[model samples]
Target: MSIQRIAAAATAALAAVALALAGASPAVAGSPHFIRNATTASLDGVSLVVDFKEAGLEAGAVETIQVTAHLDALYQCVNNGGKVPSDPKKTTISSDVSESDEFTAAKNGNLVGTLTVDPPDAASVLDCPSGQRSTLVSVTWSDVIIDDLTSGASLALTGTFSA
Candidate 1:
C-alpha cells in the first residue's frame, strides 16, 4: 500500500484506541459514597429453661441433659442491586451451661452439638457486595435433666460468637 494511505490508517487506529480508553476510564480510587437508612423489626425471643422432675433423692445420684440451638441469616443484601446468599448456620456454640444442685453436676458444662446450616467462614456476605444486612439466630434446648438432690433444680445455656 502507499505510505500516505498506511500513515492515515495508523493515525485513525490510534485515535480510536484513545477514545475507547477515555470512555471506559477506571473508577476513582476513593471510599464509596453511600446513603444510610434505618429500619426496625420485632425481635424474636428464644430461651432454654429446665426444671428438675425429681425433688428429693440420694445426693450421689447422677443426671444427664441434652440441648440444641440454631442460627440463620434473615435479611437480604442490597448492593449494585440485591442478592441473598445461602443463609449460613453457626457450627458451634461458644458457651453452654447446665445448673443443678447435684454434686456431680459440672460448674460449667460443655456439650456436643451440630449446626443445621454451614456458617460463613468470613465476616462479609458471599452474594451481596454492598451495605450490611441483618441475620437471624435461633437456639433450642431440650432433654436436660438434673440428678436427685434435696432442693429444686434448673438448667441454663449460654453462647458466644466469633467475629
Candidate 2:
C-alpha cells in the first residue's frame, strides 16, 4: 500500500472512533458492558421483569441504590369496567413505595434489585375477588445505581412490565 493511502485510512479510523465516543450517552461513559439478563419477580399480584447494564462495580461491593420506577396501575381499574379513578390517591394501592435490601452480586456478575409491591387495600378502586389478586401498581427502573466504582458508567435498564 502507498504511504498516502495508509495515512488516510488511519485518519479515517481515528475519526470514526472519535465520533462514536462523542455520541455515547453520559451514563455509559466508561467500560461498555451488557446486562446479564432479565429476572422476573412475582409477589401477590405484583410482577416485574428487571434488567440492566453496569460497569465499575466489583463482584463484592454492596451499595445502597435508589431507582425511580415508573408504575402502571391500569390493572387496578380493570375490574371497574376499565374506569380510572378521578383521584390519583384513590388507587387500589399506593404506587409510591420504597424497597431497601442488601444486594449481593452473584458470581455471574449480576446485581439484582427487586421492588416489593404493596398488597392491595380494601379501599382500592377495584372490587377484587378472593384469590383474584390485582396488581395495584407495577413499576420499572431506569439505570438506578449508587456508589462509584473504578469506572464511571451509566445504567440504562428497560423492559416491559408483565403484571
Tell me each candidate's TM-score.
0.23, 0.36
- lDDT value, residue 139 of candidate 2: 38
Please list the residue runs of candidate 2 whose C-alpha ends up more than 4 Å from where it truly belongs after superposition: 1-44, 49-55, 74-98, 106-154, 159-163
- Among residues 3 or more apart in sequence or in different chains, the pairs in candidate 1 whose N, CA or C atoms overlap within 3 Å are 69-140, 70-138, 89-118
Error of 1 at 53 (Å): 3.4
Q: For this target, which candidate reaches the highest lDDT against the unseen true structure?
A: 2
Question: Root-mean-square deviation of each candidate, in angstroms?
Answer: 30.0, 14.2
Q: Write the per-residue lDDT of candidate 1 for residues 36-148, one digit (tens) a residue.
A: 11111112244333322322223333444332223333324433334444553323343333343323322222111111223332344333343634342434333332322
Best by TM-score: 2
lDDT (Cα, tens digit) per residue for candidate 2, span 14-101: 9999999999754422342434454333334553333334444456556454333444454443334444445333243325443444
Position 84, candidate 1: lDDT: 42
The lDDT values for all models are 0.34, 0.44
TM-score of 1: 0.23
